[model samples]
Target: MSEEVGRTAQSGWEVGVSRTLPYSGARLWEFLLGREGVEVWLGAGVELPRERGEAYETANGITGEIRSFHEGTRVRLTWRPKDWDHDSTLQLTVVGQGRRSTLKFHQEWLADAAERAEQRAYWKDVTERVAAALAER
Candidate 1:
């Protein structure tokens, strides 16, 4: 069988979504890592730790462990909702050039195409929420 659009030999099914905003990378990074923004994108009522191997669970019961974190640039973690049977890797990156910044969300290790599609929609919605919040600033 031919591999699907987001399927990879190493990571399995995956999805990625991004949004560019009219803010500097530094500004976007600050907001993305800030408490309010973190709750929006990451989860509600959880402060993501900077150290790798740190585990966290949101107020809503989604759990994850930080795999890597680069100050002001990116973070990688393993995420698993309470209902999920396995963990997936998620990476968020902020790329800034001049006055604009691009926020990227990538997830891999999805179970199948359905999971990939679901995550794609989920990330798109997340980007929209993030964008809307920034636009209000």
Candidate 2:
């Protein structure tokens, strides 16, 4: 697991978590953007369309709108939990070769130190689950 936390002059605090997976970039993209794939790894049903301004929500009630999308490459979206006062931004990027890929995930505009820590742990666990699910495939 590779993780970083930093303070940005304009964004307050940001958290990043990255992993290198033994899967092709396309495979990883499928796992992230495909309905069945997300349901298995994230443990929630998602309605995601790879288009700007498209809305998405998890079965558990997390909601967001797509900010940017590049097929098989990257996705940037607004992520807002039901209780959050403001939305945070999440970006997922993938780069890889024939059979391996590096996944970079970054979340910014956190509210405070406590929220930062909480998000760090949550993302860590989520990424671990994703990797495990990929391995099982």
Candidate 3:
């Protein structure tokens, strides 16, 4: 992996994906941020806390803590991998569209070239899976 040189080194990688969820922005945020709801979609046994700074853990061991939330609009969390940078944050944006909503994903802090490339695919898959699961419900 090529290490980023310079101040931009800290900026990290940012990838975004959009999906249509059959729920409103408020409903979408509730499901993504809820413990049971997260487990049903984000991951198994996922524990997502509503309070900022609170950590969300899952059975697969992916843990993310709340960094910030904007009611039914956006939610930002620092997803910490045991072996990766703890500063990484995944920002999720929810856009209301009539009775449904558009979900946008922004995964930042993915630096290491090798890891970034892998995650570029992983995040896309994750978002697609989420959309499919939501579509089924």
Candidate 4:
């Protein structure tokens, strides 16, 4: 099935969201795994062993696909949540901006309007918390 196929037993679709963090790209990747990392961000529900192709999981039962991981630089994964039929593509990017860094996040997972709305709310909450965490450091 293509990426657009509906869930195994569903008739609806979902949407995705893009968010930006206050920190540079490198720190965002690191923060997802550091002690304060899990405590601050929404990704990395489960710890990634920092190896490509390792099976990672989230606390919410979302298994992850560590497609690309570069020590302290970047990561892209397939994030699966029990509530959705398809796993969204989650990507992280770190870039230098002036005197600071920018963390860019893109998530393409969900297949229903309602699900998209709910996921948006979920990310909004996480974004605020993550911003604070990055600010403190």
- Candidate 2, residue 5: lDDT: 48
Question: For candidate 3, what is the total of clashing residue pairs?
Answer: 0
Candidate 2 Cα errors over 4 Å, as ranges: 1-5, 40-43
C-alpha lDDT of candidate 4 relative to the true structure: 0.62
Off by over 4 Å in 3: 1-10, 35-37, 40-42
lDDT of 2 by residue, 9-109 (tens): 77788898888889999999988777766674333777676789999888877888999999899889888888899999988888877899988888999
- Between the candidate structures 1 and 2, which one is better when assessed by lDDT? 1
Ordering by lDDT = 1, 2, 3, 4
lDDT of each residue in 11-116, candidate 1, tens digit only: 9999999988899999999998999899988899899999999999999888999999999899999999889999999999999988999999999999999989
Model 3 whole-model lDDT (C-alpha atoms) = 0.71
Off by over 4 Å in 4: 1-25, 43-45
Identify the leading candidate in terms of lDDT.
1
lDDT of 1 at 124: 97
Clashes of 4: 9
Candidate 1 vs candidate 4: which has greater TM-score?
1
lDDT of 3 by residue, 55-79 (tens): 7776776787898878778878877
Against the true structure, what is each candidate's TM-score?
0.97, 0.89, 0.75, 0.67
| Decoy 1 TM-score against native | 0.97
Ten-residue segment with the worst summed lDDT in candidate 3?
3-12
TM-score of 2: 0.89
